[model samples]
Target chain A: MKHIKVFKTTMIASVVMSGLSVSSASQAANWLMLQGTEPAAAAGRAKVWGFIQAQYQKDQSDAGPTPSGEGYIPPKLIGPNLNSQQQFNVNRARLGVRGIGMPLDSRVNYFLLAEFGNNGITAPGGGDAHLTDASITINTDATRIRAGLFKIPGPEETLQAIHVFDYINFSEVSNQLMLERFPQSVDTFQGATDTPDASMGQYSRALGAVRDVGVQLFDSFQSADWDHSYAVMLGNGNGLNFGDNDDNLDTYLYWSSEMQFGGKGPRAEGLKLFAWNHSGKRTNAYNKTQEQDRKRSGVGVKYLQKPFRATFEYMQGDGMIFQGQHRPTMVFNDEEADGYYVDFGYYIPNTNWELDLRIDSYTRGENFIHPVNATLNSAASDESTFDKTTIGAQYHINKKTRINMEYSDRSFESDTATVNAQLEGVGARMAVQLTHIF
Target chain B: MKKFLMIMACLLSFSIQASPDSKPFAEKRIVLQISDPDPFKQTLVLNVANNLINHYGQDKVDIEIVAFGPGLRLLFRENANVDRIDGLTNSGVQFSACENTIKGMTKQLGHAPQLNPSAVHVSAGVVRIIDLVGEGYQLIKP
Candidate 1:
């Protein structure tokens, strides 16, 4: 009942926010100065910008039979899979103010963005007004320094803003592997607490949005036909919406080169190649003593030219979650994981239309092995693989408004403990969204 | 007491007249910053400009595109976006090239290169953006 009330409150807030006029006085440039004691400096300006995305999504999957046996399935694996569901809701309603305050003679740029679109969907930090970006960037001739809550320097798609996602949803591999594992309280693991609600495990896990509190240094060097860039970041590996959960800090490094193909200009108009690495340690919520080592590395390439673009990324990681989007059972040790995806998009010439297609594949070890006989490693019982194919279309009504429709077919390959051994099932989803920006 | 009342009335009237509803759309200013030289990103910038013009009518909106760093290539005569730039310029949009970047490029290319006829050279791109913001222009970097 309390959860329902919370949902109601969030819905009311969302409705109020949606009814707000885009040109309201609160969105005016002078509103910032008016709220503060500081005089309107000659170099300070604030611009309010954001977008609302309303979507209807539905997914249907065939579940193989449930596994039975006392020790064969861990306590954590006793519940039903939550991925087979259909939902309709506002996917995102984000509003933010970003501008230069001229604090360092305009060389220091600051941005603060928050989102209030978390009611209908189960996403990490999705249910309320949450910070998306709080960063102060200092730009210099040699390098740029950015610090605060920001997107981690990783895959191109992960770094891209959610408002500009090419499809209705992120690629399966990106959605599952690129983010930090969700933390679970010791009480929750022991079934000692009902507040988080055992059934809401998946939703709770969904809270780790792919952002971290960090500082990043980056710069770009360009030549006649190519541009090369590098960035180094240090972050608290914890998800956004909160402070660091542990004393350890995450480190990331990225390097990329973009080269123009046949273009006479120095601009990188055609091809892009990049590589990234992340190394860190994270506190295990269920067992404080087991502070886990986290590492991820990947390489990617992209071809961009006019009406056609293609991108491919391959990444591998060693962490708690294996073969799924959530953490593993305590009895099972976290294993090495790898995943990759390829995406292609084309815009219709002379029209506000576009088409997109993506294919993703991921494989990892099992989430549980009998605690007493943990060494029992069998390929038929300890591995899971997932593959997905998606195709979508988008229509741009105007610069600030867009409509997208997508269809996806997903399959899971697993060593099912089910009596029937029905390890293969296809899940399909159809989604449509309308986004308007102000 | 009469003088105090008179002063309050004048202040109220000024506040009412300064409201956004009383302001004309044509008086609004926007600055689009282009610092990345990626053609696709530059194309998105132009797309944003065209959309704003279409929505508000070119005459009702004052728009300026400020290019710096590698983004200066957008204003080159051989730029892939020159035609688009010409069309937007014809629609009353203004384009500014950073003088600092131009000087650096000239030094590197060993010649004083040419820019599109519509592009006006500014002393410095960041400083130009700051000045424009001081004048109430909304800055958008895409």
Candidate 2:
């Protein structure tokens, strides 16, 4: 243990030294700085921008029978009420206006965006319009303070501007862990039976979209050629809700150091090292008196230079894990979970084409009991593992538009053999999406 | 811990100062600002610089182009006008890149953008232009 601690210290020291040594007077910029701060030269009072993603996805596997031979469940997308084998949908339709204060005050800027899509952000609430980002930032020499509804500083995949996301779908780990889903209850035994209705207790509101109402203090500084940034935010633990559910607030801490390679805009080339931690408490929707601890943390490195780009991240969670529907019920447990993902892409030189590959794995519900049947009073300690490998390609039609095609091979495992058999023959999925930014 | 502090000190020592002092001997001093992201505008500014050099003679005139905001793209390492920038530098023309713009871009792009090696750092392009104008240099926003 002593040696391990020393080794960890040395590694951290080395990373810090490397970041400091590469410092110079000039280099790159960061996404958060660009979005939160206004440029000195003001063009207008408000500038509008947004993107739209139209997608078509199909499940490649055939419907298979469960181990019990009672019924058949078709392979579906990794979301609630999306059991269809094929569908075409506008995954995202977002529009917003952002700019400095009227009459040209660069120190104060605001960002406002709304979602008009048929995805989780709108579908769960059965609403056509949903506000995703509405924040005002006050800039000072030392730091910037932003308040309102905004994204939580978390994983790169979650924190970075979504319009430039290279993949059609998020990695499994990010989907299950970071892309939060708020259910009304944690009582798995409330309607427990031998065969519960699969859709009875599912989440009706797919809110959160990774945003919270809060205030954050963040800034980035340059040292030689490296740019280091830090953000500390205090937020209402409730996701996207205007009011806090409990007295306790969520605290988020994030730090990143990057070495610039060149380029500009969302696709710039750089090497970044980042880590973040999020801790909060969630009150059970059904049992208001009961609250569960929710904590998540991650560390990662991302490198992007011209033709080659790669990112790897490892994440861990303790308490309040979102276990997907066990046939007829959604389960939330105070259990431990961990996940990781590695993504690599290559942009063909002098061409508007890029190829991408990503692999991700997640394990949830460690040593947690699930009622097999309430009538028999039988329970089992259930655990599940999910893995996915996605191969994709992007064809850039122009600077503001691109088409992406992806094929994903997915697999699921459970400690219960019967559950494993039910998830067998889970096959590949194909998706094609076109995105245009204005 | 001691060794780590020593290395940090060494790194800090290499920090370069922003903006160079004015040249006193030059007959004419001019500062040009490029604040737009249009590629055509970028090329036009370079053309204007070339015209000024041709008319005044390279040694007789001092020219500096200060870029900020969207116009910072002109100083990008991969910019198409890299050859022109190199030619202008050889003709004694100076290029100044704004740190504010870099910071803004860094915040947006998630990293500091690589700039042309010939470009000198300035805390802010607008301030740099103001300083140059105060130093008897004519300011042009073309």
Candidate 3:
């Protein structure tokens, strides 16, 4: 019924943004913002944070019978594949307002933030989370500037940082080159639409997106433990759809740097390195006859001590376009696609412990693109080439609860009508999480 | 009396360095404006800008946080909301972006966030919030 009244108006705007960040219903001597077993470094001040997570899942599918047509070709769908052990849930509820301020004056100091999440379980605005980020930051004596809603500078294993995720996703030909570094439409928190029913993940964004609006620029230069950084961006070519078309554009650019080889904390922090670049184009077109193009590049590296966590990544993709003035028989071929991955993890080195182990692999070649653009190909049943493999786990019972797990195995080497139109089987997924922090 | 016990040990180390909430007045100057993206709200806005930079210190209170929308992934450099711009760009945290993001080059389709300009480009965002409330700053929003 109108998508359940747009999921009751995005769950009443997330219970009025968690009651405007607490402080209500007078009664219960409180001043909450608690939950921390460790992850300290309050370092310097302006604080208001939060957290919450929940999950459950299990799956399997192959439609009975073994080998119902060899080359029955089945693999790389990039969308839809779930429902085997239902009760799937994932959450991240938040509110923000950081500290320290002086707008390029008073010698320098700065920060600002905001967030909200929930994108799973029967989906629709209840998987509704909005306002991905709102920023403000500055550092002097070496230079820096990081505007708002940023970070989509071309997949280098997605720039690592999900508390540092190495596996749980890999193979599917390395997630189609890390799903072209975030950007999607629809999954509305169940509100506002001229067009949008579904299609958010398989890349990024879900239920109310605009993940990283636009604006970014960077600079970092450090020695005495080693650190280097470089960046670039010029967003809003409609990557988060705000439409009203005016030369239609979506821009983002990036360059990375990391170094700390050994000598920080937690058994000597190990190693790091990263690099990236990405490009896009589509500009103005509604009466059909629209044009498109893209480019992506990559590099990655990381390592940690103690429980041994490792990572490696490589990426390459160029000029990926679609719609030549209205499906001229659906084209494919701009040429150039590359991807790679590696992972390692173990944690018995507990103290306030959290543990994880991992594995991943990637590959490419299925009508790849980037040949100075124009003319596409792949689907003479999908011209063969794709790969995948994954295994993962995470456990932290205290300090705000957590328990996660995953297992995946996929393979495809098509051609001949894409082995009869892909979807080879061997999939299983699971989850369990409960988190709290304020 | 040994100079009154060294002035009562310098008034007990200046009342233990102004413990908790004891700032009668002098200490209120802010300048923060970021754009969003969500990495746990960029670590909950860097844990409230590390307690307002330790309740005002980075030189007797003065800070700056100006990033463009999508909150520039803490200064994106391959950031898919991952490196958090190297976990908060070397501590001192200060950045600025927005040249309408990056002029134009097409092929977006969607998921915008991720801008980097090497730093500083205050050409918009409502003219830098009316020039930081007319250079008096004190506006705070993450």
List residue ranges in candidate 2 displaced over 4 A.
A1-29, A69-75, A78-81, A185-201, A325-331, A366-381, B1-142
lDDT (C-alpha) at residue A412 in model 3: 41
Q: In candidate 1, what are the lDDT values of residues A1-438, reduced to their tens digit?
A: 554555566467445433221111111111111111111111224667789998877655443343432111111121122322455667678887765563213346677777677431234423456677787777564676888887777787776566667787777567667755455563233211112123334325434466778888875555655656678989888767457777999899988777656432211246878899989886766677887777788999988686897999998887655333223344224566788999999989999999999999887665543334544324443666778889999999997789999998877665534211333334577889999989
- lDDT, residue A3, model 2: 46
**Positional deviation of B29 in candidate 2, in angstroms?**
11
Candidate 2 C-alpha lDDT tens digits along B1-142: 6566556545533332222343445688899999885446787899999999999887778899999988887776545466677789778788889999999888776677766666778899999998988878899988
Between prediction 1 and prediction 3, the one with superior lDDT is 1
Candidate 2: residue B108 Cα off by (Å): 29
C-alpha lDDT (0 to 100) for residue B122 of candidate 1? 85
Off by over 4 Å in 1: A1-44, A65-84, A119-127, A186-206, A260-269, A322-333, A369-381, A416-423, B1-142
The TM-score each candidate achieves on chain A is: 0.76, 0.86, 0.28
Residue A29 alpha-carbon offset, candidate 3, angstroms: 26
Q: Pick the candidate with the highest TM-score.
A: 2
Assess candidate 3 and give its lDDT: 0.42
CAPRI classification of candidate 1: incorrect
Q: Score candidate 2 by TM-score against the native.
A: 0.72
Taking chain B only, the TM-score of every model is: 0.80, 0.84, 0.29
Name the lDDT value of residue A256 in candidate 3: 45
